[model samples]
Target: MTQVGEGQEAEESAPPVMTFGAPTAGEILAERYELVEHINNDSAGRLVWRGVDVVLRRPVAVVLRYPGGDSATEMLQAAVAASRVIHPNLVGVYDAIDEDDRAYVVREWVDGQSLREQVAAEGPLDPARATAVGNAVASALAAVHATGMVHGNVHPGTAMISDEGRVVLADARTDGADSQENDVRAVGGILYFALTGHWPHHEAPLHGATAGHGRAAIPDAVRDGSGAIAAPRQVRAGVPAYLDDLTMDLLDPEIAPPSSDVLAAELARLDIPADDHFLESAGTLRFTAEPEDDRSPLAAAGGRKVAIGIAGLLAVALVGLLIGISIFGGDDKDPARKPVAQPSPTAPAVEDTTPAAAAVRKLDITDVKIIDPDSRVRDELDDADKVTDGSLDEGWDTQSYNSAKFGNFKKGMGVWIDLGAPHTVKSVQAVVSAGGATAQLFAGQGNFPHTSSGDKQLVKNYQPVGDALEQYDGTTMTFSNGFNADQKYRYLMLWITELPQKEDGSGKYKIGVQEITVQGS
Candidate 1:
């Protein structure tokens, strides 16, 4: 009955509509997540929404992409990969659902602004604050890279600062197009943006960043006529020289950026005290780039060795400064000051009595396996790598039993560790989820078979290093002094005899090993 002109007018006057299959507020995906509000479309054309998980009764951020199946494979895969890594500085991914027509990822909802937004709104942050943010990002990247995964997206937009002042890195693309080196370089870009309110376009492109000059658009790094980008210190006052050098060195493609853990350690050292003023001295910590040829052999050998080398250098510098201060700190003219005591030149040179301490370094764990002998199913044997994955949040847990003695099924289960080669073991530290669990450290030689019979044989052959930790009262158990420091051990075992009772009222007993670190040289 309606006329054609009238129908056209009604369509024009109606509110703007979302594209078909697009999600809306109050709409529930997978019947558990209820979308609260649509935040915005990300650079990759995915819709970001602030939602709530009705089952958990917690707020969550939902990223939705239309036409799922083959189109949303990358997003789904990245989400799945990211979920395996559990770190405090990383946004926790809860679930990824593929509904054929659409795919959505649910993650922890951060109640704060992105670094880019904060910098744009409040200009540049002080060097101290920027360093803290950079430290958090680097730490997150270290955890990610430990799993051989790359967080392809590391721009300011992905660096989120929560309302509680916690800095977390979010939205890992893992698209395979980027390298770990690129991820490290992007941290430099983040620092540059945080210090100068400009994105380093030449070093790393900021995803979803506009090109224009407005506040909403992230401006490119200021450069000279020679096309070289200016350092952060030149752009802003109060930026520390060391921090400037570190940032520029990271941005420079010619120089290889330090590994994520090394960078994280350096940044952690440089992180200023909360009570200290930003403009004040940054203390004795300094980061300097050394020439390739002049670098120490330990520094050239990457991993924890590099960190140790850098720390050793800093320690030496600090010792020198302390000695100088002691020698020339007081004025001789001050009569109130006490005269320093000097050893007599004629006195016999005292014999150096202190014993040389054995060097303690983190031993490389080449292989790890669960030694479960009783259970035929071997349900708890899969996550053996989690203990050494460098993440405390993810761990290998034993199955719950009615009794602490594993329901009297067998004597106990243990985790075998291979050090790859013979090394002098100084100590073995095991971080457990709970206390009151009975455990012991055992040392064995040769390969230990991964079978029920082999497990029994291992228990019989392996000699106990220390007395059994009967009802250990702390979370971390360190077996030291028990190991023969002069002797080299290649294989070790952490055998857990009793499990801790769960806090839940279920009366079930289980134990989780969060981390196992061996220190030796």
Candidate 2:
């Protein structure tokens, strides 16, 4: 009888116990939605979870702050206010629940990553594409501003692009203290970051915007003594003039920020048109380089005039020849044979002699810092100098993750070198540890603080040195038209967008950097 009673008690306690203030997977919230998985944690310590609305049978994201207390008061208020306004670009709020012990806000789930992730992985977007992203955010802000509300949190981290090519702005922190002007200016910051890979405003507390020491990792347009920052064209090589003017105006405090509506209208005009399907897969806008033979209208007209002049001279010479033929004899014997011009054998062609330049000595990168864009552990890894210390056995390696796809967590990773000062680099050579890894060489002006690989635009004055790296064994990336005076750069970022398998073949992947050598004048 005692043994049978003990077995019954064990069977009764077989189910798992639910913890207070903490929700687990498959748990139902408000008895209407089921939590699927934990997505991420925001800066405010709120848990963002992927959930399903059992009643409506739709997917949702639930941002919950445990031990509700007064911590969720602000989140609840912001959700209520955002619910009042309706915009396609705005994330829809499904429901807000305040359980005294735990508070959760259920909202529409976005099927995409943040703009910060996109830029970090793919580098900067083309001018037209960057303008399109700016325009979408501006349009959304115009609506929010119209409601007498402000999107206090408007940065690359909050800007989202859907898999269907729809642009949406998420996470509006409605504190009522941040002004509409600040929101408008943030749109300019987005354009600046999109163009230069650096945040323009120093006041905005954005992730990866500040350094580990708590200083502005990326500087704004205004220089300390200089007062104002240079135009986008001055920072970047291919920025259009009109776009540069608009971005500078918004960033400059002297020039008042344009109304969200007005700014949106102007950006729309500059944006390139694309079908929804094309924009969806392309992710960024595409622009083609103009061919050398393609000329402007004025140049084409001048060429036509030169051709007409030559045709007139040829016609006159033909008429004179006809007159001479009619007056002269028509017989073949009477016609004089013309001799072709030829050079005498004694007059030898002058042979030109010019020695080709010898390759520059390998640069010393020992003083340079190694930057990782998609690092999960530490931004500046331990013993980073090993990569430049000329040691193959000991070098920089990435943190090991579960899956080959970075655990399907972050975008990608890379390593960069700041030369301390600008140099006319002719070519770059790197010895990577992993095989089948894809790397790209990017050049930029080291005018701002770049905390991580996400600082793609901070190199405000930057350009791609060459195509994505090819032939990875001590790959040599020679800048096109080597040493064209305009190619001087202080920073060189070798971003590895893809990861190769670990040497042990555990079906997991990470990257390793052995040595980096830059040959420049």
Candidate 3:
């Protein structure tokens, strides 16, 4: 998702300014305000400018557009009306001016980028972030609704989340009278975008199904309203069932997503095991779960299978979502990859493929030791170096996009070793012992010791020779070709699954290997 840092970029033809004509920063506004910088343009030719109200000497976003006819007066009236509402989540309006044959709505200037900007910079948001943000926007909507006003627009562009974790709703009912229904639907749209990293109106299944063609049901009856859209779970697999259930429930025409406070309370009920947070800590402002479909014939027949009233429809969408995920990293172990018969060797790394993903610090490991004398397996985040078995420290850091606790990940987080060639690799082999030792092997393409973020690749597991997995201790297991053994490749990943745990608040050990051995010729 995150690429090397670059300057601000706009989508398609947005031009960074939501204006009819480019107005330079510091330009005097309406003989009173001073334009600081350009923001974005709205559907109408109106542009938002961050400037200081020279008279008030306060920061404000000024919506500037040449005032024309009845439409101009009407937009001004809508602003005048919306600015009356007061709410923490809602952006407050300070003034609305109909001056010099032009209209401008003056409001508090939030010091943050829109969610859209954040997503473009960082592919998708972590789930926890999606929820917290979604809930906050929902609260903003409720506050707007409580004042007998509707936001009218709830797209990602209208929601702003400051770095401090506060949510602010921008843009309100500019239309004289569009049904309040639009505001509600917009909330749904906002939540969808926050979760999926794409707007809801695009008419596509975000990541899984084809655009405009979703696998979930749009029963003829649902076509009349919001009833037909597939459930979030069907669209994104890892999404918790409660989330799916609640999100889908909100889509019901009869059910109003309880008031924002009520909604927050409901979400709190979805605690721990009740939600996916227990499985892992995704984040507070997450949107939806990515599908867990690893398309191996088994993923087709396996994985968690659940279908309800829209059973058949959900099933199809899942198949498509799973199919897409499986193609990449759905976690299927392949036994036969390259044929035993000689095949073509893939090309080299282009020699200048820079490190694509961000990194912790560039470090060359001159030595690696998997602690074994200790007694339990621990998460990499604990000390990443299996310090329990030995001493876990010195490997803690955060890159621009990801955080790494070298020893915090399961021993199987990644495996890196020289494979010696560039041929199409078939299988991989590791002398893994469970005698309280756990290691995870992953297959991908890229330079092992020095690779680019773009080089980091993930695929299903390797196909082994025989089903050779043997468990040794509570924290360890041993195995061979139930996965593949590689011969000629660039890198390998051996993550930690078992290591010495602290017993009586004591004891430590780490399970790893001396070196990786490949099987591909």
| Each prediction's TM-score versus the true structure | 0.50, 0.47, 0.42
Q: What is the C-alpha lDDT profile of model 2 across 1-521, one tens digit per residue? A: 00000000011222322235677999998999899987655545466788899999998888787766476676788788778878888788888888878888888887866666566657767788788889899989988889988888777767877767677787777657678998998888888878876666655344332111122233455344655556667767788765676677677676566578766755664563644221112221222223457575433323444565688899999999977865663445644743333558999877768876656666555355555432323444566678788767877887665434343323344456867666767667667776656566666655344453334234223455545543233323233322356656667766665566777867666777777778776
TM-score-superior candidate, 1 or 2:
1
What value does the lDDT take at residue 57 in candidate 1? 100
- Model 2, residue 204: what's the lDDT? 39
For all candidates in order, the CA lDDT equals 0.76, 0.63, 0.46
In terms of lDDT, which candidate is stronger, 1 or 2? 1
Candidate 3, 314: how far from true, in Å? 54
Cα lDDT tens digits, model 3, 27-142, are 87667778887655444446667789899788877777664344466557667876887778777778777654566777777776667657655645655566666667766766
**After superposition, candidate 1 runs with Cα above 4 Å error:** 1-19, 203-215, 272-521
Residue 128 shift from truth in candidate 2, angstroms: 1.3
Ranking by lDDT: 1, 2, 3
After the best TM-score superposition of candidate 2, give how far the Cα of residue 490 lies from its true spot, in angstroms: 61
Against the correct fold, how does model 2 do in TM-score? 0.47
Model 3 stretches astray by more than 4 angstroms? 1-27, 174-177, 202-230, 253-261, 264-521
